[model samples]
Target: PDRIEILLGVGSMTVPRSSVEKVEMASPEQNRAIRNQWKTRYLLHEDYVPAGMENIARLLTAARDARDTARQAGSAHAADMKHESSLLARLERLRSELIRVSKRMQNASRTSSPAAYNAMVLEYNNLYAAYTVGIHELAEFRAKHPAPSDRFSFYLDSLDALRRAYESALVLPDSGQDADRARFLDRVARIIEDYSRDFSTTAVRSEHSESGIIVAVTVNDSTTGRFLLDTGAAVMTLTEQFARRLNLDTSSLPAIDIVLADGAQASARAVILPSVQVGSARCEHVEAAVIAQQPAPDIDGLLGMSFLRNFAFRIDPSSGQVTLTQFAPR
Candidate 1:
């Protein structure tokens, strides 16, 4: 039997190659090709985002570069900054107009007014072009300017919000999805909040792969071992061997039923951890389960939402940093 080794987030496992159906290798060229395809589909589609909007986008970029250069060289005036601000204001107005036109389009469809619907489509197309220009401008700006270490925590938070806003704008074909559009707008409102907070903290490096992130997690505030960060999992889980190695009292806990990823059923014991810490984020009274076996031998446990949901986190696969920040509730 040929043994095949696979790397988990924190550990490695060897399995029979005969048991596996197929395997694919990841390469830089493959990644670049995928990125190019997505860019053409979403960002460079002429039918979706008009040619005129691209001109506005170029102008906005020029204005931003000029303002930034002036500020960096200590020659920037109020008017230099105001130039970009004015363009932003105009973009916001266009977004609002697009929303209004979309609503009319939705209504016109219900009334079967072909002429009215066509007119609304024309208006939406025009407004969408302008909105696309603004979205791309801000996105490029953020990507070019990495937040300094002092502001990195909140910068990561705001970046996520901005990305969501841009994605929502791109997918919103017309105003029919008003609720979705409104949600994006609300997230955009929080971008400023993300910028206002300056929480300073150290980031933890993690071993990651295409499967997920694997990091050393501290259990009960003392013992540390390799654990997989699985946000989709409802609760934490530990293999029986790993739990025993840590000297945990698995027998004292109540038994609970768990469904495995392969649709198999298993039993485990529910245990409470006084403290569980991953990177800089920590939680107390965390619920966990101890199982007889895991798919891999080296992985001690699975870190679930109980520990992750408490903090705002960003996983940078390229950098291998899992940045976590305590967020203020909305």
Candidate 2:
């Protein structure tokens, strides 16, 4: 035989069996290793796709098609943008020519020669009409490729194509209904997670802050302060000292009773700060708990889920860098 067709899940691939020195059924360990390798490549963990061969194949196929479509769309968009730029350049040149002709026509009319003046007027009218048409064409081109809509279409097309592929895969043999639904939901979740990083921002930890992973933050649109990144904390906490320095109106703000990390219950003022900023990531009108007692020494506040929820963030302890990816609008 020239080749051996091996059935892998629901899909089959032909390979030169002769090139293989040995052929043995893969052990459970070997199968797990192979799937693990694939899972990493597809960014889909074992729990994401369910425990079945056909479901695996379907997920892989959907991912592949979506990736391919994204690549093709990107290339096409690049070429289209280049073409549009060229068209704009030509329009600019035409406008420049029209301006030059208008100036010449004005000089001709002042020369006191009727024939020359008449000829210049005729030429100017023709040039103006042509320029008008060029402007209209340019406007049409821009309207055809509006920036926001073009970006939205690319994402929409990729998602729609992947969805359709997934739906088609559901009908394939060995794809159980429960398994298919799980895989589809997981795929959608991953896509949503990735999309959340679209407007991602990054910030470096402050070197001046000594105790913990402290980063620079803006409070109430005015005060710039250092805040600690405490994942354990449920909400944003501002130190009383810092709040007083900023002249925060604590009296009128709502009060929240919270248990301190040291197992002590404390009364804290709940105030909506005008804005809180971490690097390029900023969340406006943020609700923060102002504690009269200092949570830690020197730090102005604690960066908790109240502001962190707007973006998915990761802190590199070794490099002292905090990367923030905004998943939602303010």
Candidate 3:
């Protein structure tokens, strides 16, 4: 059995092991008990034990008053301490800013120079042109050895070709060249090769049934459930209700100058479709039509170039399935 001592009450009482009792404190003891209400209320404790907030505020106000009185009394010491506190705060901020800038300078020194960004952009543009040429070359290669079923593997092969070309162009030594030298060029080329290999293509659609370069797509209108798969449209558009279901605002979008397939132009706008699935691919920020009533047949939605731009797409008539191969990055 452990010895039990009263916490709130000063006097001690003992009882049977299994029993518990309610005890009341005497008035004098109660008054003494209130001073020890909190553990930190002990004077030697390290934590801040504020005497009522209002009282602390008054003390702070008195400190300010004392400072002011010290100034009036021509005491330089008190004035100097207040000045020093403000000066130290400013110096601390300045020191922090200097440290931050020094870190940035160190990082910038380690990474790229100012000319490096421009050099990268230039290299990227050159690689883009090279990729376009590679696309044509790859098409010729695929015609010589055509296996459209294994498009991913085909893309990887094309990527390997591009990498071989890029690696052949490398004059950079492993440990000898600067970090942003021709090694940077190798990285950009490899990135392009990698990007071209994995991108997906969109399926094209036409009205009622499928036609050349056109696939079948379904669209449901709120007023009329009927949908027309329109190939004549350069961009796919959704009805106002469909747009709402896609959680898009019909208004407040940037107006797009859309040139139609008929060479006639229409003023349209960009709308983002978050959840539209294109052949099992989940796409975000899918740009759809905000404007309606085109020169050609009005479609609930038509597959657009923005989708096609991601892929090297060819509609195979022999197989009814529109084969969307991976992107060629042309």
Q: What C-alpha lDDT do the candidate models reach, one value each?
A: 0.60, 0.63, 0.43
Where is model 1 poorest over a 10-residue stretch in terms of lDDT? 44-53
Model 3 segments more than 4 A misplaced: 1-236, 239-241, 244-247, 294-298, 327-330
Task: Give lDDT tens digits, candidate 1, residues 1-330.
Answer: 599897632235799998989867647787667544543454333222332234333433343344334334322323343554565566556645765776667567735677777777777777766565664564354344422222333344444444454444555566454543444344434543443343324479898755568888988777898888887776788888778877775452336687765668789865556688876677665657789877455788788765765556778878998876753222
TM-score of 3: 0.32
Which residues of candidate 2, in runs, are more than 4 Å off? 1-197, 207-210, 328-330
Decoy 2 TM-score against native: 0.42
| Position 277, candidate 1: lDDT | 85
* Clashes within 3 Å, all models in order: 0, 0, 4
User: What is the alpha-carbon lDDT for the whole of candidate 2?
Assistant: 0.63
Q: For candidate 3, lDDT tens digit of each residue in 98-185?
A: 3444344445533457676455445444544443343334334334433232444444444445455445545434544343234334
For model 3, what is the error of residue 198's alpha carbon versus the real structure, in angstroms, after optimal superposition? 6.4
Q: Candidate 2 has which clashing residue pairs, if any?
A: none
Error of 3 at 137 (Å): 32
RMSD of each: 32.2, 20.6, 32.6
Clashing pairs in 1: none
lDDT per residue as tens, model 2, 1-330: 888888755346788978867768778888767765665555354334544444444545555465555446555655776866666566555545656766776566555788887877777677656645654564466456533323334444454455565556556566444644565556665664454333445665655354567888888777888788877666689998889878864543335687766678889865556589887788764547889787677778788766775565667767878877542222
TM-score of 1: 0.41
Query: Against the true structure, candidate 1 has what lDDT?
Result: 0.60
